[model samples]
Target: TVIRDEVGLSLDKADKAVLGTAAKVVLTKDATTIVGDGSTQEAVNKRVAQIRNLIE
Candidate 1:
């Protein structure tokens, strides 16, 4: 049971990593048009929303 649980957790972590990577990709593509000398909070929020939409 312990081994099975560990394997399950590992799989979950891998899945989450993939999803996070995908989210980052989505954010990168969408956030490129944003213009500013520095990173903007609005851009980050927009990117996060876009990523969430992609996941859904």
Candidate 2:
């Protein structure tokens, strides 16, 4: 489960179940990116389509 808020900061450390694993992560001052391991490709595709629909 991904914690989508600052409340996640309260945790000293999160377990793998709480924080999903990924191949790579890139963090910038304004953004954080996670490269998944393809296990959730279908979910990703669905989310991308949702975003595209919202954008259009």
Candidate 3:
């Protein structure tokens, strides 16, 4: 909870579990399909997507 006029950060365990499941589903897909042409932009975007899909 937030104190009066103050900001606080907290991690929700439930959200993490759900995101872990979603990442496993997304990252298991073929990288080639996600990044066609293998151009510079495609490669960069693919790498970023892979990083985001990581659970931790």
Candidate 4:
């Protein structure tokens, strides 16, 4: 998704530890909808945006 890619790009210059920490934050925030069976693609995209905003 666009938001995910943007976050990844923004974190490109981050050290591995920082990136990994960011990844954990992103995963934790998005985990529920991402792992839910009824979650739509749009829901996933919104979650990505939420995670991106948190990191940025």
Top of the candidates by lDDT: 2
Q: Which stretches of candidate 3 lie over 4 Å from their true place?
A: 1-39
Local accuracy of candidate 2 as per-residue lDDT tens digits, 1-56:
33434544334466666666788999999977778656667888886787677559
Compared with the true structure, what per-residue lDDT tens digits does model 1 show for residues 1-56?
Answer: 11135345544445543333222222364563324424369966886787687559
Query: What value of lDDT does candidate 2 attain over all alpha carbons?
Result: 0.67
- Model 1 is weakest, by summed lDDT over 10 consecutive residues, at 17-26
Q: What is the full ranking by TM-score, best candidate first?
A: 2, 4, 1, 3
* Candidate 2 wrong stretches, greater than 4 Å: 4-14, 45-56
Compared with the true structure, all predictions reach lDDT values of 0.47, 0.67, 0.42, 0.52
For model 4 the local lDDT of residue 28 reads 57
Task: Let me know the TM-score candidate 1 reaches against the reference structure.
Answer: 0.33
TM-score to true structure, per model: 0.33, 0.48, 0.28, 0.35
Please list the Cα RMSD from the true structure of every candidate, rounded to 1 decimal place: 13.3, 5.1, 11.7, 10.9
Q: Is candidate 2 or candidate 3 better by lDDT?
A: 2
User: Could you tell me the lDDT of residue 11 within candidate 2?
Assistant: 42
- For residues 17-56, write the lDDT of model 4, one tens digit per residue: 5433222222455463224434579976896887788869
Tell me the number of clashing residue pairs for each predicted model.
Answer: 0, 0, 0, 0
lDDT of 3 by residue, 1-56 (tens): 11222234335323543323221222445552232422478766776786676525
Best of the candidates, TM-score: 2
For model 2 the TM-score comes to: 0.48
